[model samples]
Target: MLIKVNDRVEIIAGEYRSRPAKGADKVVQGKVLKVIPSTGKVVVEGVNKMYKHVKPSQRNPQGGRLIREAPIQMSNVMYVCNACGQRSRLGVKQLDSGVKVRFCKKCNADQGEIAPARKPAS
Candidate 1:
């Protein structure tokens, strides 16, 4: 996946589309809270909110319904270009330092340095 934590994303599909009021033009832009590559999903901040019923516990003496962000399909989101300020596809380009970086396909502006690939556990 091209998205990482802290990356701004806009929901392009699903029921949560056009749900965020903080963004412009019904485009729900938010930071990526988590990325689940195993499930091909990403949890965006303030998107795909779900309510969970919980029992009273030590952690929550008055446990009731709690709203939380849920994972959404990776295909439903498009990366927001920092330069163009629009939802766009991401393109990978290698830097002179041998680091791979993500850039906006529309304006070809660098989004940010890509995180190093995760090493598989032994």
Candidate 2:
């Protein structure tokens, strides 16, 4: 998956996309908290919130409804470009220096380096 943890993303589809209770802007965009490449899902911060009902336990003296983010399909989100402030697809490119980096497809802006330049094999 191209999307990485800490990357800002905007939900393009799914129930969370239209949740107004979180405010218009907040409902769409969030930082990626976890990436589940094996399952092709991602857990975004403040998105896909699910309430878990629990009984009081030693760990939690007063256990009740707890809100937590659930995993959403990765296809529902698009990477938010820091340079253009727009949601766009990402592409990987290797620079002349041999460093691999991600770029925004919309504005062609470099997001950041993914891998450092490596020395040529002797």
The Cα local distance difference test for each model comes to 0.83, 0.89
Best candidate per TM-score, number? 2
- For model 2, residues 18-98, the per-residue Cα lDDT tens digits are 663353235688999999989999999988887779899999889998887889999999999999999998999999999
Off by over 4 Å in 1: 18-27, 115-122
TM-score of structure candidate 2: 0.82
Q: What is the C-alpha lDDT profile of model 1 across 6-101, one tens digit per residue?
A: 888888888788564333234378889999999999999888777779999999999999887879999999888879999999999887666778
lDDT of 1 at 64: 100
> Which candidate tops lDDT?
2
Clashes of each: 0, 0
Q: What's the TM-score of every candidate structure? A: 0.80, 0.82
Q: What is the lDDT of residue 70 in candidate 1?
A: 79
